[model samples]
Target: MSDDPYGVDVVACKSRQQRLLAEMVEHGLEWVVLTRRESVQWLTGAYVGPLFAPAAAMNTEGRVTLVLPSRKTSLTVAADEVLPYEEKWCSTLRDEQRAASNTVMMSALPIKLRHVGGEWSQLGPDLLADCEGNVINIEPTIFRLRRQKDNDELRMLRRANDANRAMYKLAREIVEPGVNELDVYNELHAVAVQKLGEALTYFGQDFRSNARGGLPRDRKIEAGELYILDLGVGFRGYYSDNARTLAVGGEPSAKQVLAWERVSEVFPLVESTVRPGASCKQLFEEVQSLLDKSKPWVFNHHLGHGVGLAPHEGPHLNPSWDDTFAEGEFFTAEPGLYHEELRAGVRLEENYVVTATGCEKLTDYPLGL
Candidate 1:
């Protein structure tokens, strides 16, 4: 129904570009470089992968340049200038790849450049030599700018979430005793792809049962175990992360049922407590307190996090970061109790978008185990 599957919007790109320009001025930067996949896509609206997505540099004057191999340029990228270098088929970037990156990014930047950018990204050694100025970490600024979802971005994310919910529904129907973990993974992936009507850019969160979370193993799920399907669907460069757990063989032990019931209680507490100015660390403690902390049957993971171009974004629901909730941010909240007593563990996650009054729940599905 839509001509642009990635939902690239020039107006949104332009608005973001303006923000970057302002950031450049604040940092006294002549140019700012972005090589990370999501960062590039954020500025240029290009659906890029880890290997081939071009590096982007924008000047204080708003001149934007995208550098990559020629073969990857067919898609409409939003840069003002497209700089292509020679390359063979798309394989992993080797020494020659590093050289190619060095050439164009150096040309686009000043002899000695400084500004806000990803310091830990795949900048070539030669390019690093030119980054003589003190590098300013721009992630916080970038996150702030991107806090409010643009209409197009919201559309893409909503589609991914819908696909996630559909896959969960299918998982409930198909996941049972004797079903191989690989089989469930394959079916859920297929369901997501079919629901989106396009190939998934990325898909994962967790897919194994009888454990906290991991890649779907080839082992057969057991009759008395709880299968945790923390599905992550990446569509059009945006991602949706949520989870559902199911009891194998359509039956669960009393301990398993109790654990799930406890996990389910966190949702209402979250709905009542999460708001624009809440402390993420405090919120994490509140959720943590509700869970049973007995030695093995304990909750020992991040409470939740934001989801966007990168599956994990900001507004971290963990004590590690001093993140504060902001209106218009989309994130997840998951509560769980682990260990053998509860048939391995029970984890339930839900997605939400922060609103003025409270937060709008984005995840649509019944929560049960």
Candidate 2:
């Protein structure tokens, strides 16, 4: 039986492969080797490793390599850890044209390999020797192509956000005084598992408070504390991340309400100005202006960032980045504030996809006290 929770979208996978092949042809390369876990997952609709694990896990001790030829013939080498999913992996290896083709799976890299990308530092001596000077770094090319979301990718993202909404709602109901952070994390994870079944690769939930710099611990939730719940979940190799701040015990104080209002108001302002041809830096600056830096409850990071196959992707909301927002790209708008003296931290984040005229929201969870 296949362990995958979501069904593979053959059409989307093929479209991605066709785009990749076009890039390879443009660069005059015969074959492209995908070593990065994200690149591999993007090309093939297969979930290879644990969602939270880094690409290194897939590169260690006989890395799981996928070699693609210009002709759409693909090869997948599975590590010992992934051998059990051999049949399912093979089933996901057909060409982008929807033709019935056999996928070659092996335990190790071939002694004589031609082109390679990603994991250059982890290749075997023999394989590296063959691909020494000819290795092509397809990272940049793949990243550019992966920026836009196809119809299928958008659907998967929507589903992932659905789970995210459920998680935040559960957090609001369960988070209260006398509860440990871990206790809330466990309940949220259980809800994710029940909703996603085999598809839930990782349930990433951080339950922290202004008590200890937002670090999770067995510490009990106390009255008048601001709790931050940053939650994420992976669906079919795609990820959804959203966060919210809550007020514990009775109503929030005047300063706490002000911090929450400022953080909450920035997102809609940022969202309103998001459209094609808008500069990311300009949006970031606009968000920064809304923050009361003179106050102690202010965050120091960029206003927001792109979210997709990886938690943090391209089109960063930073002053240094001049990249303009484009249609079909997804991003997260997060504005946060923390006050040490008041023991209050307020953060709000939501997902949006850039469209021709404007943008569409992927996550619609209510954000308030």
Candidate 3:
């Protein structure tokens, strides 16, 4: 398997670094220290593991120390440790061969007198206290910069969407009346891992008789139950999420049919409302208006949410979502209707990218049941 499976373009990574550096300067942050795994990857394309270990340590000690310097516009990580397989991947920054031990990595910073931005949870207090300069919290500034999607990010997202659709197609063939939820799960899991040769970051199967039945306690799938498969497969570190609700037997009941139709009708409406200058809140309100009040309990969630390297990102589509949709931003529009007493639910989710004119759907999953 290729090391850089996400196929990140180096030019894109460099552009992101430059853009973030400029933003940092604009935000009055001289330098930002990155201890969170996602922040580090998003900023420098550094593939260090998650902060689970540090989180465990923090729970015990109450603090962790981390040191950061001003955004290094021209800095490049050492290439010696980077595997040969990864060398094939394109990167914008020059690759160095120098290796620094963990103990001295922080002290090696070029600037000695600068304020740093970082998360306190990942960086222990001891490290923070040991740092030589002023420390600043720049989480909000960093989040704002990372939240927006760029061209290269969109390309990678498209690739992720392609893989997600392929996996979904393989999964659909395995669904049948006698199939257990776990059975379906195992089949889909194999298709993803064996055919895709990648790990699934998120995969959930919830079987319910009615929308109000709540999530399933077990993974088993039984006939007569409604199967909801919400899955996300990770390529490199990027994630693609999509969910579908299916009826096991021949056809669904009238309520299920109506629920599916409503979701289908609402999805396009949500998509049509997305654009560079559109308001997420406005789109949400329009969708609510289309819902039949007699079935007020059908939908239990927001219209949609953004997706990227993480399964969930920004530019949430909800009544209270205040973020304005920007060109090149990507998100999901998953509208659903459910009734627990009726043992029925219908939900259709699709990933989309906001364009200059409107939006583009990423996932090609059919809207029909």
Candidate 4:
């Protein structure tokens, strides 16, 4: 075991590498190249932001691509935009052996920086071609391993939940008639930054109480309308996602009140059933059964989804999916009812982690109007 980087466990990272290597050995493959951003971030604790995106003219789809062989040989080819940060991050991880680095290519840009020299193989173009037929897709194996949260990952997830709750609390407080929907949207993120010391990676608001849902506009929020505010925060590379629908003006209509009541009752009931060996399909069906039958309950999306490194992970909460709950897996129980004709919707989403006995709610914000 080596020292951890920020919140990433080096030992756990190496274990993940070995897991992938074992998969490669089983398939008789020598190496696997990873181009997806999530894959690269999982392998290395290094994160490359949008500032590193390829220029529109460059036409390069590459971000931070990695070459991982069955053995110790590995390489990360960074995009030209964020090459400097990539270099420094690589060196930091390499110094502690957190990153496998046999060569450190110097930047040719005008900026002066010390070069950690070594030979680098030109593997990008060749690996991308996969002409040798040795490269295999790493997503299947890596994504399976990512579904469960380790202790270290849970710690970061907790922080993300805290930030998300803060944002939601602020959003609820400012949501009232006469306030512009855009004002609420912008302030949610601003307050999140003030509370979390960083801007959230995902923040969304929709004020279409009269419609199924629409993006926040300059139009002022009116009384007796339903609005949805979904939020997420990235902490130590982990993520937290939660959403809530609040009433805008005076007392909610009987129909609106009923929508919240049904979701409120169903959320806990569905969430409580999550445990190792529980079927995700059964849970989805159960939640659907709890919805009000008299009114139109249109759930545009799945019942819920696993949330972690990415917003949506595996063991998807869908009746069509046969996945069963597993210990250490995190998920969201988001049962929504969208009445398009009523032009209003009510959705209550909360994060949970499957446990040995049951599931634990990670986000504890109260559920109500």
* TM-score for candidate 4, residues paired by index: 0.75
Q: Candidate 1: misplaced stretches above 4 Å?
A: 89-95, 110-118, 128-133, 137-140, 143-148, 293-296
Query: TM-scores of all models?
Result: 0.90, 0.79, 0.79, 0.75
The ten-residue window of minimal lDDT in model 2 covers 97-106
What C-alpha lDDT values do all the predictions have? 0.81, 0.66, 0.58, 0.61
lDDT of candidate 4 at residue 132, scale 0 to 100: 29
Candidate 3 lDDT: 0.58
Per-residue lDDT for 269 in model 4?
A: 85
Clashes by residue pair, model 2: none
Instruction: Judging by TM-score against the true structure, name the best candidate.
Output: 1
State the lDDT of candidate 2 residue by residue for 139-178, as single tens digits: 7787778888877678777878777787788888987888
Model 4, 1-369: lDDT tens digits are 335333446455555556555665565544444444466556554454422211100111222223222221222222222222232352343232112211121122112322111112312332233132333444567678788777666777787777777877887778888898778767876776777676555554344444555567778877877877767767645677788887887578888887777777876686668889999988888777667463566665678888778878877889767888899998888888887533378888888888999988877787777
State which candidate, 1 or 4, has the greater lDDT. 1
Instruction: Write out the backbone clash pairs for model 1.
Output: none
